[model samples]
Target: MSDEQQVGIVLVSHSGPVAESVVELARGLAAGGVTAPVAPAGGLPNGGLGTSAELIGRAAASVDRGAGVAVLVDLGSAVLTVKSMLADGDELPENTRLVDAPFVEGAVAAVVTASAGGDLAAVEAAASEAYGYRKT
Candidate 1:
């Protein structure tokens, strides 16, 4: 993939399984091998229901391919934790962004867009747009 399409993705949730499931679903939606790196940073180190800045920071770094990273969080705390993580550390890509979108739908949209060679902004927009999706 081109540099513009190499933007990575991070999924953060209070539950580990929830974050992982989103990754799985997004991967399944991808046409071929995932175009960008995707990782799940969820739960505390002890596996409890909580957010961890350390984990999120690491996940962001792990997926970063120099194109940037888009993080989708499930809860308010998740957002705070992710922000704190990114702020506290210098590991995340310089263009990393914490997206405001639904956990599952946003992840699905972001992953698909990223895999299709969309830039960071495009991928982020795709995730955010999920907020207006209708199920009629």
Candidate 2:
């Protein structure tokens, strides 16, 4: 990926202090030889209700500046929160895409795929594949 084409992965959850959980999962993926930047959502002191989306956007922007970004969020309110934030027409970059991947499995798969040097398409595909591995 180009210096301006940084790829970002987010693990969003309703649970407060999601960053810790995200780090744990990221660590697991890393142990398997996957390396990618993983950002968590929720429980920041000043973060608003839509903090997850905001954090995702910030992380993406940090890497790509104005390039397109991809974000993956967990279940429950996180989905709606992210959707609402993105739908508000805030100045998100043209390539920015906020994808709602399956909670646990998708996040893990996305992190793994990203860590393996997978591109945006590969990361998205891995997230979809994660659903297939869901335990019923």
Query: Would you list the C-alpha lDDT of every candidate in the order shown?
Result: 0.86, 0.61
Steric collisions counted per model:
0, 2
The digit string of per-residue lDDT tens for model 1 on 45-80 reads 799999987788888889888888999998879988
**Can you tell me which runs of candidate 2 are displaced by over 4 Å?**
1-6, 44-53, 63-68, 91-93, 134-136
The lowest-lDDT stretch of 10 consecutive residues in candidate 1 is: 84-93
Error of 1 at 82 (Å): 1.8
Specify the highest-TM-score model's number.
1
Off by over 4 Å in 1: 1-5, 31-33, 86-91
C-alpha positional error of residue 68 in candidate 2 after TM-score superposition, expressed in Å: 4.4
Q: What TM-score against the true fold does each predicted structure earn?
A: 0.89, 0.71
Tens-digit per-residue lDDT, 30-52, candidate 2: 57665566666554346444345
